[model samples]
Target: MEAFTLSSDFGYVVLVVVATVFLLQWLGIQVVMARKKYEVSYPRMYSDNDDRFNCVQRAHQNTLEVYPTYLILQIFGGLYAPKLGALCGLIWLAGRVAYALGYYTGDPEKRNRGAFGYIGLLTLLVCTVMFGLSLLGFI
Candidate 1:
């Protein structure tokens, strides 16, 4: 077996990580814009009077909630298969965009449009497990 060391192949995973950061930033900007449009003063996490602003805020907040897990899974899993991890990360990112767009419509149920992201998450979990097994010579 080859000794593990960072390689250029991981570039794809790095790109995906960068893309996800941009996505989170873009989503945050959307929330900020929504706050301005709805006048939901700072320090206030949500709008009591405007469901639209709340929807936008929720979209971004929800993404933040899952961000850590996604990063951990992607990075660790990419150690085993960077290309596959990046592809899954891209799929997850696309799903997040759909989710935010759907949530922006002020209809919570529509957020399910991003359900496809589960495929990426599931695969990442599998990859991570595989990496662990490989490390332990159990594969």
Candidate 2:
């Protein structure tokens, strides 16, 4: 573990990223526990026949699939553009939440409600390029 001070923009982004990562982990736990509730035995088979289970499970899996890229982008991007990184991180969090809620409890046809998270992801990707350019003194 490294000690950090949150006074700089980079540190602030780090804080936001850490918080978002924690939430993703928490969501994962929620889904795991939820799956357990669906099964007759713990550590049992996985099924998605139930719409509710499928919804949450899908949301969890989808988030997991996206989380790594978000984390990597956040870390490298925040180094050069911390404020933008923070904003993008927050947006990603919001988008993921909207995606999960819409997927878990909202209409099936409205899955696009949570798609805004991609904008944040793209922004981070650009920021990553910025970081790379900064390292190369091209920016």
Candidate 3:
């Protein structure tokens, strides 16, 4: 068995950075939502305040829903081709960011567009799984 080394190709590093950014953004949204949920603010029409909080909450949930699968695929696929995994990761991250931003604005159309991010993330996971299975002679 080979020991897992942290060093990866430049592309993996890029993927890691993108993932970290998305994770941080997700966490930030959670924090904002938590604060707003606890504290009341001035009345407003569009700001409804709660809407944004709800949006963030949903975004957090979405991130949580996808991150585990992304991580697993990234790790396994990275072992085979860090560069490719990183590229896929970048696409996923971009999609998530766009989705989060569109969702925050409460635009259904925009939110739908963001779904592409999840698709990209899933693609990466599939590639990773395929690589792992191939390496293990399971496929």
Poorest stretch of ten by lDDT in candidate 3: 40-49
Candidate order by TM-score, highest to lowest? 1, 2, 3
Model 2 error, position 87 (Å): 0.7
Give the worst 10-residue stretch by lDDT in candidate 2. 40-49
Off by over 4 Å in 2: 1-7, 40-45
Cα TM-score per model: 0.96, 0.82, 0.69
Q: Which parts of model 3 are misplaced by more than 4 Å?
A: 1-22, 25-34, 37-49
For model 2, how does the per-residue alpha-carbon lDDT over 24-128 read when each residue is reduced to its tens digit? 887777688767766624553346456666677778887888889899998887876888888998888888888887876735555568789888889999999
Per-residue alpha-carbon lDDT of candidate 3 for residues 29-121, written as tens digits (9 for 90 to 100): 554655566453434213344566556556666777778777777667666667777776777777777777777675546666666666656
Which pairs clash in the backbone of model 2? none
Please give the CA lDDT of all the candidate structures. Answer: 0.94, 0.78, 0.66
Candidate 1 C-alpha lDDT tens digits along 28-123: 999889989999998999888999999999999999999999999999999889999999999999999999999999899999999999799889
Better of 1 and 2 by TM-score: 1
lDDT ranking, best first: 1, 2, 3
